[model samples]
Structures are given as C-alpha cells and as structure tokens.
Target: MLSSWLLVACGPSQEPPENSSLTLLHPNNPSSDTETYQTENDFDLLVSDYESTQRVIWQKPDLVIAQLGDLSGKTVADIGAGTGYFAFRLVPRAERVIAIDIDQRFINFMDSIKVRLPENVQDRFETRLGKPEDPLLKPSEADVVMLVNTYCFLENRIQYLKTLATGMKNEGELLIIDFKKNNLPVGPPTELKVSTAQVKAELEQAGFKVKKTDNQSLDYQYIIVATLQKPTNKIN
Candidate 1:
C-alpha cells in the first residue's frame, strides 16, 4: 500500500540537533508538506492505509522478500519505508535493515514498532531520516536496496539513482516494486505511476543492468531487479 506521501523536493528547514545521531543517514526534516501529515489524525490515517490487512492480498510481501534470494548476512536499505511495513520484516532476514524515509513521523512510527520487537531483531533494525535529494547511504553499505510503491514520487530519478549507486557495492542489487501504469482497483492513480519499461530504461541510465523482471507475480505492481554494473576500463 502506498503511503501517499509525495515528499516535496526541498532542503531541510534546520540542522539536526547535535546530540541526535541515531539515524543511519544525516538527520534532516522534511519540508512543510502539511497535506502529507498535518495532524495526529492525518498521521494515523496514513498509517492505517499503509499497514492495512487487505494489503497482504495484493502486496504479497513474503513473495516479494523472497525475490532478494538468501539474506543470511546481507544489508538491505528500504527506501520510503513507510511504517516499516517491509523494513521490519527484513530485520530478521538481513544482517542489517535500514528503514529510510523523509517524513519524520514515519521514522518515529517505525521506531515505536522497533522498541517492541525482540532484542535481537531490534538490534538489526535502524530507522533513517533521509533527504529528498539523497538517501544518504554510506559507501558500499548496502548489499541490496529496495523501493516498493515509492519510486514514482521521486524527482530527477536518474540523478537520484546516480547518488544511490555510490552507496551500493560494485555489484550490489537494486529491487524496485511499483504500480503499473494502468487503472488498477488499488494503488495511486494510473497517471501518477511509472511503467516497467520506463523503469528499465532509467536503471540503465543510472548504471544498473536489469537482471530480472516479474510482471505476473503481483496483481497490481511490477518487480524489477537490477545490478549495479561495474565500471569498465576504470578502477573501483
């Protein structure tokens, strides 16, 4: 389920407090996008939308997670991890799970859930407040990066992917799952979505080689798996 948060592309309002260093990325506040989450009621509404039980029928989270293959000791970065719907599930599977979002409320919400998890699982999950222009992942810090129902809202995606690539290993994998450009019963408006073909082209421009694509698995979304292509005639 989409969190319906189209984070406006803007700089942070102010620097994070010096003592605040819990986020995996540089802490930054989202712009005044009151429409996204103006009040506690609004936040609660969005949370319910994202964590809806009916979502399981279409999202098929377990099948989606299996597409990443083994995760015994891998690190996964879940971009736009609204309410940790997918991030928390990755905690026990991946060695490290970075749940990232631009919205502070979502981060706080996920952190609340984190505290309730078992001690071992809690240690594996980390919430990150990211910037609109960058996810702020560390150099080669992620073995796999996933964006579910979160790609279409981005601005200047090619440039964003270039920045994201620097944070992934030389041959790290990137998995993107988003709504298809069709009038589906669920998901955002078709006009606001990105097609699988467009995603493949963008991945190529961003230096990733499309490895696999699954359009039939999910009812409303398409899956794309690409690997960061190593530089040719260039040193790492």
Candidate 2:
C-alpha cells in the first residue's frame, strides 16, 4: 500500500513550487509524488519514492543501463541523479560514476548511501552539486552522459546541452530518457512534458547527431541516443 504521505504528495508541494513539474513518476508509484521534491525537508520520503520497487516495473532500469554497453573503462555522469538511483547502480559497471544534481539534499542523500557501498566500489562513486545553469562537468570528462526524467524541466535546454556537450569525450554518446508527452496513466501532466521530436531537434542544435530513438521500451517514456559530432578540419 502507498504511504499516507505518498497520497498527500500526489499533487505539487508547497515549497520550491518551481520544481513541481520535475517529477517523472507515475501516480501509482509512490515516488511519483512531486511534493517530495519541493523541499530538502522531505529527503527521507523522497528516497523511499525513488527506490520503491514499484518504480522498477515501469522504470526498466536494467534495460536502460544496457544501452550504455560495456562500461569497462568509461566514466558516466548521471545528471539529476536524485537518490543515486542510476548512479549507485552504475558504480559496479562503469569505471566511474559521477552523480550530479542541483539539490544539496539529494547530494547529501547520495553521500549517505555511498558509505554503504562495498569497500572497493565505494571509490568509484562521486557526488557533485551542480548549478541550475551548468552541470559543471570538466572538459571531455565523461565517456557517456545520461539525463533521466530530468530533461523537460531544463530552462534553457539548448544552451544547457551545448555546455553539456563540452563535457563529453570525442565521439562520446549521450542517453536521454524522459516521459512521453501524453496523457499517460502515470507521470506529470501531458502538457508539462517534452516530446521526443523536440529532444531530437535540440540534440542536433547542440552539436549531436541522433543515433537512435526508442519509443516502445517503457510504458510512458522515450529513449534518445545521440553522439557528439567530431570537429572537421578546415583548410586555411
């Protein structure tokens, strides 16, 4: 049964109302409540929602991670890594996992979980507090970058992607998964979502080439795979 707080959180919360539209949850999923994100005070509830088993049925995390292929020597950055849902999971697979987010509460939450990782893999995880305008990734630092359920909320998405592209290695890949713009049984209201077409176009505008678009995988989301374009040599 969903907790009482979960029921109460289905609607937007009081504080940080600006983030009310950032939730990627289905109403059935306890974490689907957007209220938990309104403030750092609800960290505990937010964790429960993010890590809930119900989310796995719809999130299909393993399949999503599979898209990154073998991460033997790759450094993957998970943007908006609330509660390290994908970050901690990638720790054992990738050479390194940088969990980036704008909220310090989520950052601290991930740090708390980091202490419990197996001794060897513990070092593989790092949490970074990012700014609203920038993710603060170093030049060519990531082999693959991911933004799950956090793309639509971006204010200046094109500019953000341009800055994000600078952080990827040459020929690096980017994986984006977000709720489809539809009246789905779960997820935020349809009007608040971004369509796959818009995402693809923005990726192109930001210097990436769309490699694949998968719309049938998740029940309510679409996956976009794009690669950074290589700089062409110009004759002087």
* Candidate topping lDDT: 2
Give the true-structure RMSD of model 1.
Answer: 9.3
Rate residue 111 of model 2 by lDDT: 91
Residue-wise lDDT of candidate 1 within 128-193, one digit each (tens)?
998887999998899999998788867799999999998898889999998878876555556667
- Give candidate 1 regions above 4 Å deviation: 1-41, 232-236
| Stretches of model 2 off by over 4 angstroms after superposition | 1-41, 232-236
How do the predictions measure up, each by TM-score?
0.82, 0.83
**What is the lDDT for 231 in model 1?**
81
Candidate 2 local accuracy as lDDT? 0.79
Which residue pairs in candidate 1 have backbone atoms (N, alpha carbon, C) closer than 3 angstroms, thus clashing? none
Candidate 2 least-lDDT 10 residues: 1-10
Could you tell me how far off, in angstroms, the CA of residue 138 lies in candidate 1 after the best superposition? 0.5
Q: Cα lDDT of all candidates, in order?
A: 0.78, 0.79
